[model samples]
Target: MAQAYDPYTNVIHTMTKAMEIGHIDQSMFEILKNPQRETKVYLPIEMDDGSVRVFEGYRVQHSNIRGPFKGGIRYHQTCDLNEVKALATWMTLKCAVADIPYGGAKGGIQVDPGTLSERELRRLTRRYTFAIAPIIGADTDIPAPDVNTNPQTMAWVLDTYSQLKGHPCPGVVTGKPVELGGSRGRNSATGRGVVISAKLLLALEGKTLEGTTVAIQGMGNVGANAARIFYHRKAKVIAISDVSGGLYCEEGLDIDAISLYLNQGGKLLKDYGAPGVTHITNEEVLTCKCDVLVPAALENQITEANAGKLQCGCIVEAANGPTTEGADDVLEKRGITLIPDIFANSGGVIVSYFEWVQNIQELTWERDQVNEMLEKLMSKSFQELLNVTEECHCNFRMAAYIVALRKLVFAEKMKGIFP
Candidate 1:
C-alpha cells in the first residue's frame, strides 16, 4: 500500500528512519518532530468586484537551532499548516545539509491566486504581510518566493514590511526584484541547483550532462529554469509539463523558443507548438523515456502508482516532497538513484542566504560570482551527502536526511532545551 499522502507524516517518517539509522539520540526527537511555532492568519482582501473575502494562511517555523528561521511563502489554494510544516522541516534539513546558517520556516496562504486580479493579488499579498508582520524581520524569520509567488510578490512583502519598520527593510524578504536588493542568481537558483546536483550524481558514474536525456514535470520557475539550463548544457529535454499540459519531443524540443514563447505571458504548454513537439499528459511527462526525470511540481507526484513505472535512470527532485516514502522504496528496489529535494533544490535558499547577506551588508554581487559560489556550495554538500549515503548503506534521501538530522540533533544537544 502506498499509504495516504500527508506531507508532514512522510517527512516525520523519513526523519525518524534517518535518526535511527544515523544513531541520533532519540531524546531530541520531540523537538524535531514538532514545529517550534505555527501561525495562522485570516487575510481579508477587498476584491475588485467590491466584495470582501477571507483567506486562510499559515507560517510554520520548524526549527531555528542553527540560526534564524528562513523559508519561502507560497500562495496556493491547497496550502495548509501540515503542508507548510513539512516544507518548513525540509528547509531546516536543507540548510543543515548545505551547512547554511539558518533554520527552517514556511508561509502560505490558501487561496487560488489565479482567481484574483493583479490589483487584488497585490492587495492580498500586502495584507498577508501585515498579518504576519510582528514575527518577521531582518533578524527573524524571512520569506522568499515559492509556488504561485515570485520576485514581484517578494517586492510587495518587502515594501509592506518596510512600511511597518519606518525604513527600507530589504532583509525582511528575499527573491525580490534585483532593483530591490534581490540577488542576481536568486531566480534560477533552485533549478540551477537541481542541475548541479544531477551533474554531481552523474560525475560519480563517469557521466556528464552532455547528451543526457531528461524529462521534467511542472514547467514552473524551477522546472522551466532547469529545463533551459539542461538544454544549454547539451542535455536533451525530451519532456516538460506545466499546469496546463505537457509537451514531448523525441529529437528534443527547442527550449529557447519554448521559453521565449511562454515568457511573453498568457501562454501555456497546450498553447506551445512547434516542429518535433507533441502534446502529452502531465503524467506521461513523469514516466517518459529519459535518462533523468526531474519532478519540479507539487508534492506526492511520484507516488507508488507511478514509481514502479518510472523509466528514468535518476530523479532529481526539483520540488519538495515530489517522491513519497513508498515511491522511495520502489525506486530503491529498481536501482534508480533518487536525488532528494532538499539537496537537489537547495540553490534557492543558498541564494536567499546570499541575498540576506547582501541586504544586511548593503552590497550586491555580480551574477557570475553568485553562480560560482552556488556551485561550490552545492558541490560540497553533494560530497557530504555521498559520504553519508555510503556510511549508512542507505538511499540518497535517507543519507541526506541523516546528514541533516545529525547536524540538527547535535546542535540541539549542545544548546539543550530552554528553561
Candidate 2:
C-alpha cells in the first residue's frame, strides 16, 4: 500500500533530496528541517443562534532568518499543525526563491468557513486573530488570505488586531481592501504570476500562450483569476474545476462569463451551465487533454495514482504543495515538466511584500506599476531558476529548492546560534 500523504514529510523529503543534489551544508539542515515555533489556539466563537463552538487553529513559524515571517491564513476543515508547518516551510522557500525579504509562516483554522454564517465567520475571524495577534505584526509575521479566505477575512483580522492594540494597524496583515492600505493588483497577482511562469516555460520551447490549451483545477481566487488572465492572453482555458466539480469546453471556455457567475454569490461550477460547456468530474479535469495543467486547489490533488494519466505537457502548481514528492518522481520519469509551487505561486507573497512595503512607507502605487514590478521580479527569478537548473543539471523543482536552501542556509550561517 502507498504511504499516507503527509505534507510536512513530503517537504522534508524534497529538502533532503535538494541538499543531497546541491551538496549543501548539513549543519543547518537540522535547523531547516523543523519549524522555529508552532502555536495552536482553541477559539471559542458564539454563533448567531447564541451557541458557542470551539475551533482549532494553528500558526507555524518555519523561519525568520531571512526576514519577517510572511504567509497566508486558510480556513479548511482538514487543517492541522503538520499542514501549516509544511506550508510555512514552502513560504520560506518561496520568498527565498523570489529573492524577497521575508521568511515563512502559515496559519489555519479547522472549520469549514462555508458552514458558518457571515456573522459567525466574522466572530471566528476576530477570535482567531486575537489568538494569534501577539505573534503576528508588520515587522514580525504578516498574514494574508489563502484557501477559503479573502480580502474580507483579512479586513476582519486587521480590525481585531487594531482593536486589541488600540490603534490602526494596517501593516499587520496583507490582502486587505485597498481603502485600508492594501496594494493594488494584489488579488490577481498570483494568477498573473502563474501565467507568467507558463509563458516563461513555453518560451523555453519557442512557444507562446496565443493558442496554448490549459486546464486549471480549483476555481477559487487563484484559479479563477488565472483562468481570466489566461483567457485574456488568448490561451484556451479548456478545463476548470472547483470543489463542486469541473466544466470543460473542447474549443475554449468563457472564463469571463463563468467568473461573473461565480462572483455573483455562492456559486459552484457543477451548477453552472452554458452552451458548449460540459460538466466533468474533478478527476477527469486532471487527466483531460491540455497543454498546461494548473493544480490551483489544495494539496495532494495530483498524486501517483493519477500522475501517469495526466495529459498535459506541463504542470504549473498555483497552490501550495499540490504535487506530492511521489508524484514528482512519477512526472520526472514521464518527462512531464512540473514547475514547483514555491516559485510558481510566489506571486501572491511577492505582491504581499509590495503591499507591506507600501504600508510601511505610507505610499500607494498604481495597479500598472505594481503589475510591472511583479513581472520584473518574477522574470528575474525565473532566470535565476534557469541558471540554477543548468548549473545543477537538475529539474526546475530541485533547482528552485537548491536556490532557496542556499539563501536560507547562508542567512542562518550569518546569524549563527542565538544564545
Candidate 3:
C-alpha cells in the first residue's frame, strides 16, 4: 500500500538530499529538521447563530537563527500542525534562498473560511492573534496572508495586535492594505515573481514569453496574478483552475475577462462561460500541453502518480510544496526543468520585507520602485542558484535547496547554542 503523503517528511528528505549532494556538514541536520517552537491554540468563536465553535489553530516557529520569524497565516480546513511545520520550514528555506534577513514561521486555523460570516471570521482572527500575541511582533515574528486569507485578514491581525500592544503597530504584519503600511505591489508580488521566474527560465532556452504557452493550476492570488501578467506579456494562457475546477482554451484563455469574472466575489471557473472555453478537471490542468506548467495551488498537486504523465517541458512551482519528492525524481528523469518554489515564490516575502522596512522606518515606496527592486533581487538570486547548480551539477530544485541549506547551516554554526 502506498503511504500517505506527509509534507514535513518530504521537505526533510529533500533537505537531506541537498546536504548530501552539496557535501554540507551534517552536524546541524537534526537541528534544522526540528522547529524551535510549536504552539497550538484552540479558538472558540461565537458563530452568527450564537453557537460557540472551537477551532484548532497552529503556529510553528521553524527557525530564527538568521533573523526574526516570518511567514503567513493560512485558513484551511485541512490545516494541521505538521502542515504548518512544513510550511514554516519552507519559509526558512525560501528566505535563505532569497537572501533575506528573516527566518521562518507559519500559522494556520483548521476551518473552512467560506462557511464563516465576515464578523465571525474577524472574531476568529482576533482570538487567534490574542492567543499568539506573546511570540509574534514586529521584531520577533511577522505573519502575512496565505491560502484563503487576504489583505483584509492581515488588517484584522494588525488591528488586533495593535490594540493589544496599546498602540498602532503596522509592522506586526505584512500583506495588509496599503493604507495600513503594506508595501506597494505586495498583493501581486508572488504572481509577478512566478512570471519573472518563467521568463528567466525561458530565456535560458533561447525562448521568450511573447508566444509561449502556459497553463497555471489554481486561480488564487498567486495563480490569478501570474495569469494576468502572462496574458499581458503576450503569452497564451491556455489553461487555469481554482477549487471549482479548470477551464481550457486551445486558442488561449481570455485572462482579463476570466480575472474580472472571478473578482466579482463568489465566482468559480466551473460556472464560467466563454467562447471556445471548455471546462476540465484540475488534473487536466496539470497535464495540459504547454511550455510552462505552474502548479500554483497547494502541496502534493504533482505527485508520482501524475509526474510521469506531465506534458509540459518545464514547471515553475508558484505554490510551496506543490510537487512531491517522488514526483521530483520522475520529472528529473524526464528532463523536466522545475524552478523550485523557494526561489520562484519569494516575491511575496521580498515585498513583505519591503513593507516591513517602510513600516519600521516610516516611509513609503512607489509601486514601480518596489517591483523593480523585486525583479532585481530575484534576478540576482537566480544567478546564485545557477552558480550552485553548476558547482553541484544538480537539478534546480536540488541546487536551490543546497543554496538555502548552506546558508541556514552556516547561520546555525555562527550563532551556536547559548544558555
Candidate 4:
C-alpha cells in the first residue's frame, strides 16, 4: 500500500528521487531540499467593524541562485507554512525548468478572501505588505497574484510597498494593473503557457489543437484564461469548473458567454444555465471524457483513489501538486501523458519575469511582444523537457524535475557552499 502523502514531503521526495536518477551531486541535492528562508508574520488588521483581527501570513524564499525570488501571494483559508513552503519550492523548480532568471518564493495569508469584504481585504493586503516589506523588493523577492488573489491585490501590494518607501516602487509586485508597470499579458500568462504546452505536446505526436477536447477544473485566472485560449485555438473545451460547480457539454459550451457570466460576482456553474449544458460535480469534471484534463485547482485533488478514475487522454496540471505521488504511479502505469504543474503551468511566472524586467527597465512592452516572448519561452522549455525525458527514459514529471534540479544543483556547485 502507498503511504499517505504530506505535500511538502511528497515534493521533497520526488525532487530527491529525480536528483538520484539524474546522477546529480548529493551535496547539491542536500542544499536544494530545504528553503533558504521562511518568515512567518502575524498581521493584525482593524476591520470595518472596528474589531481587531489577527491573521497568519508566510513568505518562503526557496532559492536565489538563478535570480530574485519570484512567486505569487495566495489568499485562501487553508494557507499555512507547509503549503507555502511547497509552493515556494515549486516556484524555484518551475523557473529553473523554464530557464528563466528567477528563483522561487511564495507568500500567503491564512484567511478566506470570500469571507472578507473588499475593504477588509484591502486592509489585510496592506498590513501583510507592511509586515514583509523589508525583505521584499524589486530585485529581491517579487510577488504576483495567485489563488483568490488578482491584479487588484497586487496593486494594493505595490501601493503599500511604495508608500513605505515614499516613492513609487512598482517593481515590488507584478500582475498589477497595467497602469502600474505590470506587463500586458501577465494576467493570462499561466493559461497561455498551458495552451502552449498542450500545443507542443500534441504537435510532437503529429496532432494539432483544433479538434482536441479539454476539461479544466477550477476556472479562476489560470483555468479561465486557458479555456478562452483553447476555445480561440479551435479546441473544444468540453467542461469547466470553479469553486461553485462545473459545466459540461459534448459539443462544447459557449466560452464567451460563460466568461462574461463568470465576470459578474456571485455567479457559478450550478446557476449558469445554457443550452445543452449539464451541471456536474468537480469530480465528474475531472473524469469526463476528454483528450486533455487540466486540473487547475488546489493540491491533493487527483489522489490515489481519483487518479484511477480519470478518463482523459492527457493530464496537464495547471495547479501545484495536483497529483499525488501514488496517483502519478497509477497514471504512469496506465501510460497517460501528464505535463506536470511545474512545467505545464509555469506561464504565470515566465511573464512575471517579463513584468519584472519591464519594471526594472522602467519600460512597458506591447501585448504582442509580451505574448511572443511568452510563446518562445514556453515552447523552448517544452522542447528541452522532451529532450531530457528522452535521454533519461523517464516520464514528463520526472524529466521536468531532473531538468530543474540540474540547473539548481549546478548553480549550487558554482556558488560553492557559502562560508
Q: In model 1, how large is the Cα lDDT of residue 59?
A: 91
> Could you tell me how far off, in angstroms, the CA of residue 397 lies in candidate 4 after the best superposition?
0.5
Cα deviation at 17, candidate 2, in Å, is 0.4
Over the full model, what C-alpha lDDT does candidate 4 score relative to the true structure? Answer: 0.92
Tens-place lDDT digits, model 1, residues 179-232 = 989999999999999999999999999999999999999988999999999999
lDDT of each: 0.93, 0.94, 0.96, 0.92
**Model 2 pairs in collision:** none
* RMSD versus native structure for model 1: 1.0
Pairwise lDDT winner, candidates 2 and 4: 2
Give the clash count for model 3: 0
Over 4 Å off, model 1: 1-3
Give candidate 2's total backbone clashes.
0
Which residue segments of model 2 deviate by more than 4 Å?
none
lDDT of 3 by residue, 194-280 (tens): 999999999997999998999999999999999999999999999999999999999999999988998899999999999899999
The Cα RMSD in angstroms, rounded to one decimal, for candidate 2 relative to the true structure is: 0.8
lDDT score of residue 201 within candidate 2: 97
- Candidate 4 structure quality by residue, lDDT tens digits, 1-419: 76765789989989988987888778877678899999999999898889999999999999999999999999999899999999999999999999998999999999999889999999999999999999999989999999999999999999999989999998889899998788899999999999998988888889999999999999999999999999999999999998888999999988999999988978887899988999999999999989999999999999889888889999999999999998999999998999999999999998998888888888989999999998998888888888988898999999999999999888888889879
